[model samples]
Target chain A: MSDLSVDLGFLKLKNPILAASGTFGYGLEFEPFLDLNRLGGFVVKGLYYGPREGNPPPRLVETPSGLINAIGLQGIGVEAFIAKVLPKLQALDTAVIVNVCGASEEEYVRVVEALDAEEGIAACEINISCPNVNKDGACPAFSPESTRAVVREVKRASRRPVIVKLSPNVTNIVEIALAAQEAGADAIALVNTFLAMAIDVETRRPKLGNVLGGLSGPAIKPIALRMVYQVASRVKVPVIGMGGIWSGADVLEFMIAGARAVQVGTANLVDPDACLRILGEVEDFCRRKGIERLEDIIATVKT
Target chain B: MFKDPEARIVGKESWGDYFLLTFDSPAVSALARPGQFLMIKVSDEPYPLLRRPLGIHSRKDKTLGVFFKVAGIGTALLARKTPGETLDLLGPLGKGFNIDPCLAGKPVLAVGGGRGIAPLYFLAWELRALGASIKILYGGRTQADLPLADKLRAEGFDFACSTDDGTVGRRGLVTELMEDEIKAGGGSPPALVCACGPDPMLQAVALIARDKRLPAELSLESRMGCGFGACWGCVQRIRRDGKAEWIKICEDGPVFPAESVVWEKESP
Candidate 1:
């Protein structure tokens, strides 16, 4: 059998499929359907310094091939996650990547420091692109200097490898990817959801309660694949590509476009077992192609 | 809850812009109760990102039926689905209506307006079998808007109807008819009042019921993401200990005591 194992610098995955942050709702929610240990790893929901109630109603809106959500990073916060959620998550066999979101760089450092001391956290996925909240005049992930600063601060504060998540709603993703890498990020996950909005024409009002939301789904695959290809080629750190990934075919497209791993987001909303199904399909495709190692396909750009 | 091993579009029927699609999900049927809903993924596309929250119309052996009005692109696509097609479906989720056993033999009234009648059908059907006197009061914009009147009549239910255009049994809102019935029945409230419909109508009914100190239950509708409680998208404002509290409709209830709801305020 070909090796599906991938060395993401400090982290190792038995397979290249990991559940995207927020979509999986921690690993335990899916326990009733499948064995968590059988998958590569799971990313927990976005974490803040304190518990967050998140945005108002209509936080999610549906698009033609994807969904836009302004969830405003609703979560139990880092302390609660570590105290209540982490113990249960740590018991699982798969790697646990905590997704951290903060209003400012200092808050991000505080969250990273707490998770860094935790026993089971394999890595930290720095979320700098969340469009749900309004905080600083600028988001650290949006600017090269700010992205580098946050990455450097977290890397300095935490012992675990930091995977900076980049926003897709940027002019050039390669610059941000390179900036995070230059700031000592061990790896990077791109792209976070895109900024989007929907209006109820009859009511003449926005569909989502938050008015603006982050768009993710099959509609974003092509753009995400392109971004992954560009960033993967530009950055030296491993890149985790995600946007509307639904099937094994999509996984292959992302890998071949230059992603070390792919994260499945909105598909989980469609089918709770989507992650497992994608994993099975990937393995089946590998077996059918007589391909031994899944890593061989990463960055296989067609000339 | 048993896992819904498969999701196949077993039945599809269209009525104007509305479509009724039946999915074969034994897990949902086995665990489904009245007033609960399922999170349906209408298309694999991302335009309509979140799953559509659909009320369970009926559940037979291994299949669950959902009735949807084509309000948006998702429902429009759902309306065009053919049988033998497959769509992804998540649950028989959220808390449904509560049937008080103590009021089993007592008279009960069910109020529905437009598509609100969807859940009431199951409630009336189940109550009738339990030997309860079920009186159904339904209303709509016009005669054609009432989809299941014939079925309810055929079920031998003592039901009254109303339409805004005066083309039906009575002119004006269904709440007006409910008030008339309560007056004719000696001013004492029915054993219980269960209602589901437009918020304005429900608010009116809730006001009258609360004034009379009548025990009433209402089924609320909200746009939802994950039908499971994990999303917390479907929340309603309720009064707890004299303070307003946010209750998850997906978990706490699609059903709530009439007084528990903050009728004039938007959901939190």
Candidate 2:
């Protein structure tokens, strides 16, 4: 079998396929669908300092080849996650990455510091990119300065590798990516979700209760690829890419575009076992092409 | 375990804008209960990217059925599917109608409003199997909409129906029909009420349940991103412990007690 493992410098992943945050819940929700150990890792839903109720109804709307969602980062808080979810996750053989979120830089540090004492957490993907919440311009991923500030704080508080998740709704994605890396982020995950929205023509009101949401799915794959390619070309840290990955071919495209690993986001909603299926496809492609290792193909995109 | 099976479509039936497609999947059919639903990937393509959530209509042996209305691009794609084709289905998901054994030999009522009637048929069948005397209140916009009325009759189910245009059974809303039954009986109301339908219809049913002191369970509808709890896409405002919270409808319920439902406020 062609080797599908990936190393992001700080830690080694059995494979490049990961279940993205928000889409994968707390990972335990999928225990009945697939073996968690089979995946490289899965990022749990974004957790703040305390439990949040998230947004109101009409949180999701499907567009052409995409889904716009404003789930507002509802979660069970860092304490509950450590108390309830971590024990079950520790029993499993998979890497459990925490997607940390906060209303402020202090909250982010607090969450990371709390998680520092936890054992099962493999890494912390700082979720400064979610567009569904942080309406007060608090989304750190929107600006390089704020991105650097939060990533620096989180990296300091986190004992595990810190992965900075970036947003595409910015003027300069590469600049923001570089900022995260400079802040000592062990890795960078790009293209969280493009800011988008939909409308009900009959009622003339926004389809999402939040009026605007982050769009993810097959529709945004090409744009996400371009961003990952651009950012990976410059940033020194390993780049983790995601945004609308549906199949194994899609994951391969991200890797080829310079992403060391790819996270399957919206596809998880389409099929709970999408990661396994995509991983199989990657394996088949590798074997068919006589490629022995996935690392040999990272950033192999022809100029 | 929740299974995502590529279930082969074994049967198909159509009536204008409505259709019923049956698929053979032991995983889903075995675990499926009344009021549960399935999220079907309508097309291999991504234009209609999200899976369409359809209520489980029937379950016999290893086959399951989904009754749906071609309301949008997703359902339209699903309607074009023919027998022998396959559908990617993720189910038997969400909390279904609670079927307590005490319901046996008791008066049970099932209500459906148009396509909302999808899950009620399976509910009626299950209730009847438990020796409960089942009565179904089915309604739609016109005669063409109440396509399952004859099917329900053929199965020897006791039912009543209504349409807005007076094309069928009663000449008004199904809620009106329910009110008439309660008043005309001049006796104890049904022991339990199970309903699936448009929000307004469900709201009316909840109201009826409230006034008559009858226990009611409602199967709600939402535009779901995933039929499983992972997406957090489908949520409903529900009251629990005297406080209303946004509950994930895909997991916590597609079925909820009528009293817990926080209905939309009627326009002034």
What would the per-residue lDDT of candidate 2 be over residues B157-195, giving only the tens digit for each residue?
Answer: 998999999999999999999998888767867889999
Model 1 spans with C-alpha error above 4 angstroms: A135-138, B2-24, B41-51, B60-63, B80-88, B230-248, B263-268
Instruction: Assess candidate 1 and give its lDDT.
Output: 0.82
Please, what is the whole-model Cα lDDT of each candidate in the order they appear? 0.82, 0.90
Off by over 4 Å in 2: A136-138, B266-268
The lDDT, on a scale of 0 to 1, for candidate 2 is: 0.90
Give the DockQ (2 decimals) of all models: 0.44, 0.81
Chain A TM-score across all models, in listed order: 0.97, 0.98
